[model samples]
Structures are given as C-alpha cells and as structure tokens.
Target: MEELDEDNMNEIKDKHEIGTPEDHLSEIMEEAEKYHPGYGASVMTGDVLIHALEIKTTSFCTLRCKDCTHLIPYTKAPAHMPAEDLMDDIKKIIRVAKVAGLIFMGGEVMIYPQLAELMEAYSKEGFYDRVGFVRVTTNGTVVPSDEFCAAFRKIKNGYVVISDYGILSSNRDEAAKKLESFGIKVNVIPEDLQWRSLGDWHHRDYSKEEAEELYRKCHGKLYLHLYRDHLYHCYRAPVMNEDGLIPHSDGDYLDIGSMSVEDLSRRLPEFLTGLSCTKSCFYCDGFHEQSPFVERAAQL
Candidate 1:
C-alpha cells in the first residue's frame, strides 16, 4: 500500500466539482449488469460489493452520550455538514453503486437545517424507488418541524428510526407521534440496549492478520460511510480522524468524488477490505461479542 502525504490528502479533499446522483444513475444502471430484487445496481469494488450505503450528514448531536459509535461525543467541536456537500457525495455514490437501502444519519439528524430538502432531493431522483427503504436514524429527542415532517410524508417510503433513550429523551413520544401522524413508519430501538466500548479512544498497534480478524467481527465495518468526497468502509474513520485520534491515509478510504467507476472498481477492495484493520481500531475497543446491557442515552 502507498503512504498518503498531507499534501495529497488535502488535494483529494478539494477535488470534487461535478455530477449528481440523478445525472449518473442511467450510466451506472447500464454498467450494472446484475441487479438484486430490491437493491438498485450491481457494481463491484474489487471482489466485494454492497447493496446498502450509509449517509452520515453531521457529527453534531443534541445529547452527549458516553458511548457513541460515531465518536461524536468526543469531538472537540461538532457541526452540521453543509447540505450541498452531502448531496454531492450522495450523487456520486448513486451514480457508481446500486443500493438496496440508504441510511440517513447524523450527530442528531433532526438538527440539520436541510433535512427536508435532502429527503426531497433523494425522492426527486427516484432514490426511494431504487432501495428497499430510506431511513433517517435519530435519537427521538427533537420533534421535527412542519416542513421536516411534511418531507417525510411526501417521501412515502421513508422511515424514522428512533433510538429511544427512555428518561433521557423528553420529546421521544412527541417526536414519534408527530412522525406517525404523518403516516411515516417509526422503527424503535428500545432503551435497554447492548453497549460495547468501541475502543479506549487512543492509539494501539496490531498486526495485519489480527486487524483483519477484528474487522470481520466488527459491525461498524458493515455500514460504509459516504461523506465529503470519500467512501469509508467503517463509520468510525471520519470522526476519529477529526478528533485527531487516528492517522489519516489514502489507504483508509476511497476518494469517490475523484475516481471513476473503473478506477474504484479495480482498486477499492484492495485497501478497503484487504486491510487488517483501520487506524481507528487501535483506539477502538475492538469487538465484544457479549456487549453488556447499559443505560441508554446516559449523559456524561
């Protein structure tokens, strides 16, 4: 694997300037020779392929829980990603990949100002038709405004995934009620939940074999993140990188905004799935099969 210098990393970040999901879906569909029943396209990244894409809108949340998979609570400063930036990545992904589901999430998804507009864009592109479901994961604490709720109703197939924190959420019921009233399905994650220490939130070293084994057992590895211009195999990388908890390398992610489907298909899986583990793994708790039950949404 080649080492990525700081200059190259910066350049990669600034490279994207074109395309949208709607614009390229037709081209991708042509190249997508195989298709799953509910999943949209059939494209390959090396030998590995995915039917789902996880879209993380922001790292800023309303509550500061101790254990966040996203490592958002540990961020020194969290902010909502610009809606325009997020839409750009979504466009690039839909162009190159066929997806069965799209998970829209954030620090607190309700707080994003463009929540309604984002949903609208996805729907306008007929994104809902391509996937089994389009879900927005939320803490169930913020009751969305009229506009946001309206967007949910309009999408028809959109779902509200609520992580109910029991006593921690003063508005959980209200929020669910509002969403349900709009005829949106509410998927609830009860307060009683399993908790695992993702990591010590510090760096550690591991051999390639060990890291690969860890990745196999890790759940975060399943939900590859599409944020900014990069596609990350694990959701942990961006937040951990932002907090200076892990070193950033080109090997750690794919610059989806810059690379063509041919280029990504040939090279992505080598560094993405071939790696033993990510730099974030050193700081992460690795995996605990029997994650203990803990208080949901307990504050620091």
Candidate 2:
C-alpha cells in the first residue's frame, strides 16, 4: 500500500480528483466488467463506483459508545433483505452495471448468522468475480468462528474493516489475529478520540467542519451515501431523521429496485450538492472525524 502524504491528504480533502459522481460510477463499473463481461452497457455507465450498496442488516447493537451515531437507540429494525431479494438485486447489478462491490453493513451484521449465507449466495451466482471486493464494517466485539471463516473463504476477495472503539477486550488484537488466521485481511480503524469532544459543547467539535475541510482537501471527492431507500452522493448530503427523508434540490430519492445504473449516472450532479439540511447536522464517525491515524501523523 502507498503511504498517504500531506499532498495526498490535501487532494482527498479537495475532492477535485474524484471526478463527477457519474464519471466515478462509470469507472468502477467498467473496472468490474474486466472480470464479468456479461454485465450490460449500463454497467459501463452505472454509477456504482460513486454509489455503494450499504446493507443495513440490523438496527440494534450490543455496544453503546458515547460518540455512536446511526442513533441506534432511535432507529428501529425495518426488515432484513430476504435471500431471494438480495440475490436478485445482486444479479441485476452484475448484469446491468457491474457494481464495484457490496458493503455489508449494519448495527452488527455478524449478530445475524444469515450474513454468511448471503456471502455464499453471491459466490454461487458467479457474481463474486464481478464484485471488486466484499467489505464488512464491524465492531471487534465478536471473534470469527470456524463457520464464519468457511463462509468468507468461498469468496476470493474479502476484507473486514474493524472499528476499534477502545472497549473491546485485548484492544481487538485477539480478534484481528483470529480473522487473519482464516486467511482474511483484517484492517483496524483507530478510534477517533475527537468524537469525545462532541459531548462537550465548548470543546471545539470539529466533526462537520473537519469533514468539509477533508472534502475540500480531497478536491471535492465524494463517496456514495446509501441511506434508507435513496442514494446520496456524500454521507452527509441526505436528511433522514424521525421527521422524514428530505433530498437536496435537484435531487430525487428512488427505490433501489427502480434505480438503474444509467439513472444514477445521469443524476450525479444533483447528488453532490451540500444541502441545507447540513445546517443542523451532527457529525458521525462515518464522516471525516479525527482518528488516532491522524494523531500519529501529527506526532511524526
């Protein structure tokens, strides 16, 4: 892996190099086509690169950290995507625009044993190759067991991104070892202590500010934000709270099933705007929050 330098960090914050959301989507789908050519022309145009599928499996979690967003307590368990529905969507994405990959996320996807089955289904459909990678974001509260290892082994490329909240035992070292033992790459995301500052009104909470700065540094680079049923360009671009979901002007929220790669590619511009809803926004770790990774660079 290449080292991320000041210049690199600046570029990422600027978001300039990321290209328009549409272009980004096209690029990823095209890349996916390298492995699966059966994908449709829309796969070459679909905005899967800029748009990532975020599968929210569960609303409840065992850990309740101080800076936890997703407002787990406030969220309710909707419904899990049935095996058939998920498979159908995966097949469509592969046939249509070749998605870069699927991000299996949740309050805790591991808690649901069916997640392994989900991975196996992708493997069976010959769609795994079309998927650039399969990443799962999890808190290192549970270690990978034999069954979990076997499920992931079916997929050629898989990674586990562990968010270390400083509460897990052994500082998550044991869990990392367990996953690596299964021939899986385990990456640990250092806990962002700055999250603690959010609890204090005057402690210079820089979550959103830093995110903007980081966005600018990345040259206006934007990542896809999939929430509820609609997809927004950036994580903070959409408003989904207890009241209702509001989209930015010129932006429309479409059901995932109704959405085509071309439809998303065409709407890239409207998706990237910084909406008014951001005015009262509270930052979550999902966005750019100061982490130990940043702190280490400062010391150097």
Candidate 3:
C-alpha cells in the first residue's frame, strides 16, 4: 500500500469536487427537451397537476440493490432527518409554493421509527387535505407494523409507491396487498427491467430500444422534475447527479417558493447554449439520444 501524503490527499479531494464538471445544467436541460418533450417547461410553469417534494427519511437501506443511485455506497451509516426539521420544511414548502404533494423517499422510510410522527404532524397542521397526496417510495423489503399502517391510514391522501427489482426477497406483491388492506393506495412498479451495474452505481438500464419497449409495457412515460428554486421538467435522476446535490443557480438546496415560472423558462436557452464541453456529459443517457447539439456536434 503506498502512503498518501498531505498533498496527495488534497489532490484526491479536489478531484472528487470536480468529479464530473463537464456535466453542466445547460446540457441536462437540452437533453431533457430531447428525451421528454415539454416536460422541462411544464415543471417550470407548474402546469402539471402534481409536483413532488422528496424528504429523504432515512439514508440507510437494509438491502443493497446493485444499481442503487442514491449514492448510498459512499457512506457506511445512513442519516435520518429529524422529525422536527422535516415537518418544518414541509410546512414551509406547502405554505410558500402551493405544492400539490409530498414524497418521502429513502434507503427506507419505513425503517425510520419517527416516520409516523412526521406524517401525523402534517395531518395535525390541517394541511392534510390540501396536501393533495402523500407518497412513499420504498424498496419494499421491510413490512410496516400494524400500528404504523394504522397511522398511515389516517391520512386520506396517503399512498405507497414500491419499486420492484427482480429479486424475490423484495416481496413487492405481498407488501402492496398488505398496504391496500389498510385502505392505502398501493402502486407497484413491476420488475420488467433488469438491473445493470455501472461502476459503483446500480441502475435499470433501458437502452433506447428497451426504453421504448418498457414504455409500451407500462403504458406510461418517464418524466423528470428538476428542482432548483423551483421545479424544471426533467427525469430528475441525471440532472441532480450533474448538479452535484446543490442547486447550481443559487448555491442552495432547491426552494420551490422562491422561483418564478418565467425565470425557469428563460434559463432553458442558457442551458442549451452551454453544452459544448463533453466530460460530465458522458455518463448521461441523453448523450446517445437525439438533441440539437448532438446533431450540430456530429456535423462539426
């Protein structure tokens, strides 16, 4: 093992910060338009009836799915959001942005003991009905207790969205049935796609051909919501990965209330014009998909 000196350590840290800089907001926005038309602009304008606000409840997962893209591999222990802080942020978003819904996502939200408390807080605030809907995206491994389910049942608009990997242990069907028994709407994402490993990240790779096939099978479309001061139409995964977890335009976590629809719309052209550098753009699926720059660069 070679010893790493102080200078060597600093260089490694710097490299990680610039882990993938060529990946820029402009390129992502352009790719958004190409892969999913009108999605970018719709999110910016809030024309879509539903808007998602995700609170990562627990940062750790009991099961290790190969293509886990939440960057869970980088840390040993997952972080949990304090219920108080989580509720405060939720209230603020609802009051300021007129958001339609809230999504609780995580390594596993059910595993967080305080999840029931957090949900109850929303109901107590009288924002429950106005909340439009509450959805939880989980890996479908841990089954919530009867008491937990009872609490979730109290929220009239609550539901669960379970992602089914092909692994049998996920027991997605059983989980959905159980949640439905409690009068909660259960949406199961079937395991139609195979998981592929990309370096340390595991993802469901839908090649252009595979994606088209999957679209037909699911009878739906893939959409992305890019959130800065507000949401922008996007596939969510790639743009957030490119922005390095902080909102690029304002150097803050995305705060929906602070943004205007017009401001988000105007940024689109700027994003398109800035996609010349190709370093960070390499990992994106949009690279292969058709786009204005892709056509122009091909000519050059």
Candidate topping lDDT = 1
The models' CA-based lDDT, in order, is 0.66, 0.50, 0.48
Per-residue lDDT tens digits for candidate 3, residues 83-121, read: 776666555545544334466766677788788887777
RMSD of each predicted structure: 12.1, 8.7, 14.3
Ten-residue stretch with the least lDDT total in model 2: 291-300
Q: What lDDT is reached at residue 244 by model 2?
A: 36
The Cα error of candidate 3 at residue 12, in Å, is: 39
Ordering by TM-score: 1, 2, 3
lDDT of 3 at 141: 78
**lDDT by residue for model 1 (1-300), tens:** 122354644454333221332333343333222222323333334324444468878777889877676777877667777777777777656555545556889889998888888877766776644455567889877998888887777765567888888866778899989888888878788765434446546665667676666666666665678766678877777777655666665666788778766776676557444766776666665543423323345576
Over 136-249, each residue of candidate 2 has an lDDT whose tens digit, in order, gives: 778777775667767776666567878776755233777788778888777787764222111211123556666455444331123443455545444333333321332233
Q: Give the TM-score of candidate 1.
A: 0.78
Work out how many backbone clashes candidate 3 has. 9
- My TM-score estimates for the predictions, one after another, are 0.78, 0.58, 0.54
Better TM-score candidate (2, 3) = 2
Residue 119 CA displacement from its true place in model 1, Å: 1.0
Q: Give the best candidate by TM-score.
A: 1
